[model samples]
Each structure stands twice: as structure tokens, then as C-alpha cells.
Target chain A: MRNILILLSFMFILLSCSKEEKEDLPKDPIILPPYNPTYVDLNDRLPSYLPRMDIPADNKTTIEGIELGRALFYEPLLSGDGTQSCGSCHNQSYGFTDNGKKFSTGIDQVEGNRNSMQIINAGLRTSFFWDGRAATLEDQAFGPVTNPIEMHEKWPRAVAKINDISTYREMGYKAFGVVQLDSVLISKAIAQFERSIISGNSKYDRWKKGEYQMTPQEDYGRKLFNKDRDEIRDSLGNVIQVIPGADCFHCHGDLSDFTDNLFHNNGMDEIFTDPGREKVTGNAYDRGKFKVPTLRNIEHTAPYMHDGRFKTLDEVIDHYSDGLVHSATIDPLMKNVDIGGVRLSLSEKAALKAFLLTLSDPDFLDNPDYSEPPPL
Target chain B: MNMNTVSKITAILMLVTSLALTSCSKEEEMGCWPPLDVPGDSANVIMIFNATTNGQPLELLKNFKDPLGRTMQVELLKFYVSNVFVSFNGASTLLKKAALVILVDPNVTDTTKKHNEIALKIPYGNYDRITFSVGLDVVQNAGDPTKYPSAHPLSINQNTYWDAWGKYKFFMIEGKGDWDGDGTLTNIYGYHTGFDECYRSISFEKMLTLDATNSNETLNVNFEVNDVFFGKDTLDMKLHPSWHGDINTIETAFIISDNFQEGLRLN
Candidate 1:
């Protein structure tokens, strides 16, 4: 009986010691499972001629990170209420833009002030947003989640929700090799996913590579789109000859990017309402300027312009044709403004739309890689 | 590893970090580190730009009569101070130079901060002269603020640099003037000074001795409000009510910028 008591005491000590060690395993760096990060490689995928993306050193593209980001992106759990996600506004079917909606509805069903833009080829771009307020994609992700009218969720609560889930911990470890869930790591992962959403495989790209052919009207529109000169003029502002091309290339030029990536006061209105770039840059001269968006996937993305005032491409073409309002801060690129606009005829407007359609890549929109993953 | 081992490792790491920080602090005790240095002990000076009415800090929103008996109330005063070249000796050689541009808003005063404080850390010695440029020199002022990081001093958010005008506003001030002197401040008077022609570098030759024992000083760099309008060329509020970044305000811009140099006093 005495020997039996000593044996039982020895067994109890072993059991208690093992339990204590198990509780403290996470604290012990040596005992924890080695965090093997899934590295993402995209060297061969991107075109050679295009300049390399300026990815932040801290947030390198990782396969696990991008996958986790895409999962977080589609998961409505990130919203204030588990009802809306980034994919809700930026639907993949519409080239990662709003689904023909003028303004996207938030969690509270409140409409946004500006048009939701597609972040295709965003990694190559320097500044983020229409006003270029957010400097980086990582910085830009912080906006919609906390904006009072948008997601309406505080970052602390959003991070806490993701931390509560066991799957996120596993995914976080795979991406960052660190189990700690923070807003910075979350932002970086989302930025990586955004940067990976490249839209360079359009019909126009294939046409440039001599892989496809454009329709007659589409070809005419392409010519007008790249039109830099509107007839040669003398020292005086007189039209020596009536140039019949749409002078749209100056502000929206550079073939591959399809945008100058600069802000312009494109004679939208005579008076300022939503002081676009002027809010970021306090200069009075920049009162009406806004960042020029890329023309890629223009057909899929509708309700054009920053405010989404024009519903269709025809209305947009009409604005540049004759509806341009003269402003004191008008860009010098609006050279034909003396005659009101480019004055594209009825047939010319239709042709411009045809050419814009060639920029849409159906393959990109239907890519399963871009689609939301199956339930975790 | 167990809890005991983890605690031991943390304590060792803390000790190492404490020692490393102490070594760095010892080196920072000297005013100038790495390249620029002088024999004497280094000292720091906290400079303030104040709007004054008869040698006293001028209060905004309070109507005061100027020398011309014009009732005025200074609503806003903002300017940039950069290219701080301090000369210890009477010679052309500069004692120390700080290559930084800082915005100074007199309305918000906390002398320790970047916006309010214009610190000068120079070698402790008696000097015949001290000089600095009031505005960004030609090269420093060049570059689109949009290209720079958002948090930088000369970023577009400050409203100092105008891309359309292609220049930085060296000094800006606004006030309400009662031109008729009926004691009612109705009319607004603004002097938005800038352009390449207005950028001025002023030099003050005064006998200033640095106390080696007490290696710190606070200097009052007063920008007399009246001097900006009345010196050399008086502002014609009737002719130009608001002088913005246009060709119309070039004359007033020159007058106000010229007075900025003449209005200085290192107290």
C-alpha cells in the first residue's frame, strides 16, 4: 500500500509537468512549429518590356500571403456587419470595378461620393485613389474599412475578428511566418493581392503583339485615341486646317499604361464642387484637377468619370465633343476648347466606343485564381 | 524551452539594448556629429517668429491702429524658413548650415516642435555675424510637391508651393483693414508673397557670444507685422484687396518679401 502511494504521486508529477509545458509552448520559440512561408514567384508571368513593380521591401509577394489576402477580400467577415466585402463593390465580372453602379452602397446602404475605380495594374502606379491622397495600396486599404460611410468598422475590431478565427492564424503563419495578427500585416497581404490583379492581356494587347485584328470602326477609334495633334496651327490660335481626330491622347496617353498617370483639370465644370486633387494639394490653381484613370477595361467599367455623372460611353464622348465647360483652371491640354471640344461626329463617337471595347480582357474577369475561394 | 529559460534570455537581451543606447547617447551629447565640428562646445538656440505691435506680441482678432492710423487685425501669418547658414566669424566661412525647410505658423506656439522652433545648434563661440535665407533657394524650391512623400515639410498639403505658378510662397499674411478708420474691420487685406524674384537671403552682423558653460539659448526673431506692409513700398489695400498667385500681385509680393529681411531682430 505504501509503494502504491509513491507510484501514484510520481505519475501525478509527470502529468502536471507535461500540462504546464504544453501551455507555455507558444512562448518557447524553439519548441514552436517552424513557420515555413509560401513564397510567390511571378517573374516569368509579367511582360519583359514593362517596368518592374515597386513592391515594398517589407511586403514581398508571397503565394500564401496572396491566397490569404484573396480569402480575406471575399470574406464578408471583414466588414462592420458580415454582409459586404471588397468584392461586393469591386466585382470580378466587371474587371474588378463596380457592377455598372454609379456609386457603391456601403454596409449601411449609404452611397459613396465618387465612382468605384478598378485597381488593375495598380502595383505600377505611384499614388492611390482619385485624389492621390493614399500614397500606397497598403495605405489605401486602411480607408474603406474605417470610413464612416463605407465599411464602418474600426481597424482594432476588424483585426480582432480575424485573430479570433483559428484558420487565420494558420494562414498568417504560412504567409508571414508569424502567428501574430495585426493591421499592418493584413494591409500588406491585401496590397499583394491587388498588385497581382494585372490586366495586360486584353484584345488590344494581343493586337499590339500581332495576335489579333481590330474591326474597321475599332481601328478608326484606335487612331483617334492615339491622336496627339489636331491639325497644325500657326503662332496665332487659328485653325489652319480642321483636324477630324479626337484629341484624347495628351492627358490619357502612353500606349501600355493608357494613362499619363498625372492629374488634370479636364474642363468638367466651370465651378468646383468636389475639390478633387485640390484637397490633397492645397494650391488654389489645382481646384478642379483629378487623377486621370487608365482606359484599360473601359467597356466593362461603366458610369464613367470620377463623380459617375455620365452613365454611358456616349455621354462621355459627348462631354469631350462639345459639352466641356470653360474654367480658369482648365488644363492647357484642352487646346481645342476655343471651338468648345473635339467635335467628334456621330459616327466618330461610336467608333471610339468600339475601340474602347478592345481593351477588355474576358479571360481576366473569368480567371478562377481571381475568384473567391471555397468556404474555408 | 520552458518559462524560466525564456525569462533569462529576455533579461540578457534587455541588458544588451540598454548598453547600446547609452553608447549612442554619449556620442549625441556633442552638438555636431560625424562630419561638421568646431573646437568649442556645441550649443542650441530656440528661435521664434512673432508678430509685434510696439515691441509686444500682437494678438489676432484685436483691432489695432498702425502708423498710418489704419485699423487692422492680423487674422493669419504663415511663412517658410530654410537654408539656415550661420556664420560664427566675420569672414565668409559659415559656422554651421542646416539643410532643411520648415514651416512656421505663429498662431500655434510650442517652441519645442518643428513648426514653431527654428533651432540653431552651432559651436559655442563669440561671432561677428549670423546669416540665413528666409525662403528656399533656387534649387531647394524646385520639384513638384506631389512627387515627394506626403509627410515632408514642403509637401502640397501646406499650400506653400503652387505648381501652376511654378514657385513657392516665401511668406503669407492676411488681415482685415478698416481703411476709412471708422473702427470697423470690414475689408480684407492679404499679401500672398512668392515667385523667384521675391526669394531673399538676409544677413545680420551682430556681436553674439556663446556661453560655453550654459550650452543653450532662446532667441526671439521678431517679424514686425507693420514692417511687411509699410517698409519701402506700402501696400495699397484699395488697389489690390487680395494678392493671390497671379501676375497682378507681383508688386505687393516684392514689397512684402523685401520687408521680411528688414523686419528681423535677433533678441
Candidate 2:
């Protein structure tokens, strides 16, 4: 009986020590099992002329994150009625824009005034949206999800609904090394997928790489697009032939992405009904200003302008050529504002349009990777 | 406690301490300018720039009279300062590298007014003069912005690079005015100075001293914004409301670049 007591005491001590060890363990140790995701070097896929993307240090790009983000982008459960998704408004065929619609219709059947911007080369932009409202893509993702006229869903409910799905819970764990998903993680995933929608394989890019040659009209249009309104001169300082330049490069000159990523009031109207960038900056000087969008894939991403007023690119060229209206906050780059426009001749306008079409990349429109995934 | 138990607790505490220290290690600071080696007991030098128009603080979007009495309102002003060198009796010491591009924009908000100032550390001494350039050297001017970080001044994100022309705008002055004395400001003018021919080197001869007793010193530099439009030749706003990279206006770009040098004074 004495030996039995001693043996029981030793067993109790061992049990107590083991319990103490268990208590010492972390309360919420990160278990990343089945979460070994492959890191994606986004620069490897980007063009050589483009600069490195400013990816957040906390949210590095990964295959698992992109896949999860793609799913969430197409997930209708994110909306209030489970009838709308981000993919519904931002279709893949029309360069991620609403299909030839002036304004996008929301889940609530309400229409927004601003055109749905294309999602091409979004990773290269410093600011997002027509008014440059969102500073980062992650910040931009938070807007449409909760906007009353857009998705019309509350964040708490949306997060809860996403968390309720076991598939998303598993995907969230694999993508971000956590089982519990939040609005921040969801936005990050969507932004990652958006960053992957690159469009650098356009015909213009091919011509630049010497893989393809542009036609004479396209070549002439390229020269006109780049040339300023200033007159040409000879080496002897003699006045040479004056070329009617289109002057499009001043605002959209970053060839890698085809946008200077700056705001400008391009003299669209004398009095703005919607005060474009003023809402964001609260400055009178910025009243009519709006973000200068990239011209890549401009062929499919029409009608152009923030209002989507023009149905065809020809109307856009005509507006720039002969339809400018002077305003107080018009950009100084619009030097020909007095004449109402740049005044490009008919032939010049045709050539410019032909060159603009070279920016269209069929490969980007048909990429299966950007397509909606099968039901989870 | 028994010896075995005490040893186990000791190991646990050691592991916890190690993990805590590992997580608390300092992170390296990110930027274009890194801390450089300087002599012990170095003096602090601060370069202060005050932008003025007709001896008054220049305000953006406010109507002001030019030399020709034309009502003009300056909207934007930005310039580059590079290759800062301090000289003592013909011997020069480079205070900042050429690759270190410093952008000076007086239009910044009062909270960020320090953006117009530059700070440096040097050995205590009396410098006879200082020399700097208002533009980048040829090689640096045409550099690929993709090679630099986004935070760099020469990076594409800075919005100063003319990617279409493969060059940087050394100086930019954009504004609008009423050339015909109309109540409304109608004429828009922009002068972008760049290219190899437009680069200007400025020399300011002043007795600048940094002593051991007064380890901290400041040098004030003033730029008269009015001189940009009035100095040497009165810029005719009616004939040329804008100057771009066009071959006809290249001379105007050069003239504006020269005027930028004329506007500087050591105070």
C-alpha cells in the first residue's frame, strides 16, 4: 500500500507538469498547415519598361491568395441579395468595364453616375477611381462592397456570410494563414487578383518590341500622338512644315502603363455639373479635374471619359480635336483652348484612331485565368 | 522545487526570452538618402530656401502683376537641385551625391515646409563658397526610373519625368494670366525647362562658417519668383503663352532656365 501511494504521487506530479506545459503554450498559435502558398514575383510577368509595383509588405502576392481573391471577386454571396458580384459590373470581355454602359447598374437596381473604370494595369497606379479618391487598390476594394448604389451590403454581414462558408474558411486559411476572414483580408485578396489582370501584350507593345510593324497610318498617328503643338524647325533655325499634333502624350505618356497618373481638367465643359475632383480635394482650383486614365486597351474600354458621354472613339477624337470649352480650372496643357480644340484634320483624326486601336490586346480579353471559376 | 523541475523552468524562460528578442530586432530605414560616414563631432548644416515674389511670400493661384503689369497667377512650381558642393579656397567637397536628387517645391503646405530645406552633416570648418546645379547631368537626366525605388525623387512616381521624351523636366512653372487685361484669367502658360542644353550651374560666394562651439549652422537662400518673368528679357506672354519641347520654343526653354539662375541669391 505504501509503494502504491508513492507511485500515485509520482504520476500526479507528472500529470501536473504536463498540464503546466500545456498552459505555457501560446493561446493562439498560428497553425499554417496546408497553407504553404507559392510566392509570385509580379515583376517577372510585367514588361521591362514598367517600374516595380509598390506591393504592401504585409500582403505579398501569392498563387493561393490570387486564387482565393478571384473566387471572392466572383462570389455573389458578398452582396445583400446574393444576386450580384464584382464580376457582374467589371466584365472580363470589355476590358473589365461595364459592357458599353454609360453607368453601371448596382445590385439595388440603382445606376451610378461615374463610368466603371477598367481594371488594366491597376497595380501601377498611385491613386484609384475617377476622382483619385482611393490611395491604394486595397482601399479601393472597400468602396464597391458597401456603397449603397453598388453592392449594398454591410461589412459585418458580408464577413459573417463569407466566414460561414467552409470552403472560404479553408481558402482564407490557405491564402492568409488564418481561418477567420475579415473585410481587410477579403479586400487584399481582391486587390491581388486585380493586380494580376495585366495588359502589356498589345499590338503597340509588340511594335515597340520589333515583333510587329505598324501600318503607315498607324505610324503617322503614333508620331502625331507624341508630337506637341509646337511648330517644327530645321537645323538652321528655319521654320519648317507645321504638323497638327494630337498632343495626347502630355497626360497619357507613361508608355509602360500609358498614364501619367496625375489629375487634369481637360476643358470638357465651362461649368461642371458634377465637380469631378473637387469632392476629393475641396479646392476650387481642382473643381473640374479628374484622374487621367491609362489609354491601354482603349479600343474596347469605351465609351470614353468619366461620364461615358461618347459611344465611339471617333467622338472622343472629335471632342479633343474641336470641342473643348474653356473653364477657370482648365489644365494649362490645353494650350489650344481658345480655338476650342487641337483642330486635327479629318485625315489626322483617322490616323490617330487607327493608332489607338493598336492598344487593344486580344490576349488580355480572352485570358482564362481572369475568367470566373467553377462553383467552389 | 526539485532540480529537474528547476532546470525545465529555466529552459522555458530562456526560450521565451530568445523569441522576444528575435521579434524586437530593429528594422532598416528605407529612403533615397542613407546615413553616411562623417568625422566625429561633426557640425550640422541646414540649407533654407525662401521663395518670394517682389519681396513677398509667393502664393499659389493668387493674381499678381508681372513686370509688364500683366495679371498672372502661378499655379505650380517645382525644380531640381543636385550635385551640391561646398568649396574652400578652390578645393571642393561634395556634400551630396549626384544620384541623390533633391526636389524643392515651395508650394508645399506649412506643415511640410521642410521639403524646401536640406540638412547635411560635415566636418567643422569655414567654407568659402557653395556650388550647385539646377538640373541633372546628362547621364542622370536620361536614367531609367524603373531602376530606382518608388520613394526616390527621380522615380517615375515623382511625376517630373517626361516618359514620352525620355527626359526629366529640370524645372517646371505653370500658370494662367489675362494678357489683354481682361477681368478673367484666360491665357494659360507653362514653361518646362530640361534637356542637356538647358542645365545651369549656379555659384554662390558667401563666407559660411561651421565652428565647434556652434555645431549647428544655417544658410539662407532666397529666390525671387518675379525675376523669372522680368529678368534679362520680359517674357511676352501674348506671343508665347507656353513653352514645350517643340523645336521653335527650345530657345524659350533655355531663357527660362537662365532666369532660374538669375533668381537665386545667398542671404
Q: Highest lDDT: which candidate?
A: 2
What candidate 2 gets wrong by more than 4 Å, as runs, is A1-32, A231-241, B1-40, B98-113
What is the DockQ for all candidates, taken in turn? 0.02, 0.34
lDDT of 2: 0.79
TM-score of chain A of each: 0.87, 0.89
TM-score for the first chain of model 1?
Answer: 0.87
TM-score of chain B of each: 0.73, 0.81
lDDT of 2 by residue, B142-259 (tens): 8888866786667787677777678888888888899888788989888877887888899989777777788887878787877887777566656666776775568788778888
lDDT tens digits, residues A1-376, model 1? 9976885585345335431223212222222245676666553455543334667778888888888888888878778997888888889988777898999889998998889988777776767788888888899876888887778887767776776666776787778765545677788888888888877688888887888899999999987775532443354645476546676765554435666566777789989898988888785656788888888888888888888899988888998988877665566456445467789889988998898888898878888888888887
The clash count of every prediction, one per candidate, is 0, 0
Single out the weakest 10-residue window by summed lDDT for candidate 1 chain A: A23-32
Native-to-model Cα distance after best TM-score fit, residue A225 in candidate 1, in Å = 1.1
TM-score versus the correct structure, for each prediction: 0.55, 0.87
